[model samples]
Target: MSKEQTLMKLSAILIAALLSITSVAAFSHSGGTDSKGCHRNHKTNDYHCH
Candidate 1:
């Protein structure tokens, strides 16, 4: 493949990898909880106590 084509492929792969990583990081949790045993809030991304 030409140099430009190879670079484009690499860029695309890197972008896809970054997006996947970001989504995983954003969704994956460590089972966080508050004093009252409330879990995280999906809308605010903060822990809440019941």
Candidate 2:
């Protein structure tokens, strides 16, 4: 492949990887129960795992 094409592909792949990693990190730190996701449940005073 040409230099420009290779660089572009690499950049795209890198951006995708970074975005996925950031998303996972954000979700993990959301403070949810059972590792589903964090949210307040109206039925009870418990954190939702949805």
TM-score of every prediction relative to native: 0.53, 0.51
- Stretches of candidate 1 exceeding 4 Å from the true structure: 28-50
Model 2 residue-pair collision total: 0
Tens digits of lDDT, candidate 2, 2-48: 99999999999999999998887665433445545567665796675
Of candidate 2, the 10-residue stretch with the lowest lDDT total is 28-37
Look at candidate 2 and tell me the lDDT of residue 41: 62
Q: Which ranges of candidate 2 are over 4 A from the true structure?
A: 28-50
Q: Candidate 1: what lDDT?
A: 0.81
Per-residue error (Å), model 1, residue 14: 0.2
lDDT of 1 at 32: 68
